[model samples]
Target: MIDVLAPAEAIHAAPELGAVYLSAFGAPGYDEEPARAEEFATEQIPLHSQRDDFKLVVARDAGKLTGFAYGFTGHRGQWWSDRVAAAVSPELADEWIGGHFEVVELAVVVEAQRQGVGAELMAALMTDLPNRKALLTTFADDRPAPRLYRRMGWKVLVPDLGWDSALYGLNLGVPLGH
Candidate 1:
């Protein structure tokens, strides 16, 4: 089952999460460098955990970490938000950049792919976000991640934001219920 983790717990589990991230993205079809796994787990996750409204969720089966997803509220001055803001129009930046839940990473081990793990992770990640919407960037091709986002009602905000990536947005009307 997928369970949300408090920031402390997520930080504590960063090492294992790094392993899963490495395994998932290092597999064929992802362009990430394998060396980044350690850095992401040790540095990025820990730093991101300090952000406001940060959240992380991990899926475990038979005590093995199968997948995880995490994000935090986006704000001005952040590197990613700034870069995205610069490329997009003032209207898009105004509506979808700051204050949105920025989905930072979602990964599932190769063995867990195509089994609804990604979908479940996303649903749990966005179920009750304080933000009115969420955003992410993924490869601009017909990949599983992009397909899953589109399937879940995320619209394409920018066909090519940069680095061969596409920006996506989801207007989360009322966080599951009023």
Candidate 2:
């Protein structure tokens, strides 16, 4: 089942989560380096957990991690938000940058793919967010992540924003479950 993780729980699960991340993103196209997973667990997750409004959701089967999604409230001056804001037009930046929830990572182990784990993780992570909007970036292809986001009503605001990726936005002011 998918469940929300408190910051402490997430921190505790970092090692296993790193393994899951390595397995998931190691898929054919991503070519993610093995050490990146270690950094994600040791550096990124812990740092992000300190952000305001941080939220994380994980799915486990038989006590093994299958999938997870996490995000936090975004604000001006943060590196990611600032970088994205600089890449897009002022109007687009103003509409979607700060005051939004930034979906940092969503990964499902290869064995768990196409079984609704990603969708469930996203639904649980995004639901009940106090922010009026949310944003994420994914490769600009017809891949599972992009398709899942589009299927859930996330709109592509900027194509090829950087690294051949696209910026996606969701209107939380409207109802979810799309």
RMSD of each: 2.0, 0.9
Clashes of each: 0, 0
- Which residue runs does candidate 1 get wrong by more than 4 Å? 174-178
Error of 2 at 127 (Å): 0.8
Superposed Cα deviation of residue 6, candidate 1 (Å): 0.6
Model 2 agreement with the true structure over 1-178: per-residue lDDT tens digits: 9889999999999998898899899778987999999999999989998999999999999999998999999999999999899899999999889999999999999999999999899989988999999999998887989999998889899988867889999999766556
lDDT of 1 by residue, 9-99 (tens): 9999999999889988888777568679999999999999999999999999999999999999999999999999999999999988899
Return the TM-score for each candidate structure.
0.95, 0.97
Q: Which predicted model would earn the best TM-score?
A: 2
After TM-score superposition, the amount by which residue 105's alpha carbon in candidate 1 deviates from its true location, in angstroms, is 0.5
Give candidate 2 regions above 4 Å deviation. Answer: none
Cα deviation of 147 in candidate 2 (Å)?
0.3
Q: Judged by lDDT against the true structure, how good is candidate 2?
A: 0.92
Every candidate's lDDT: 0.91, 0.92
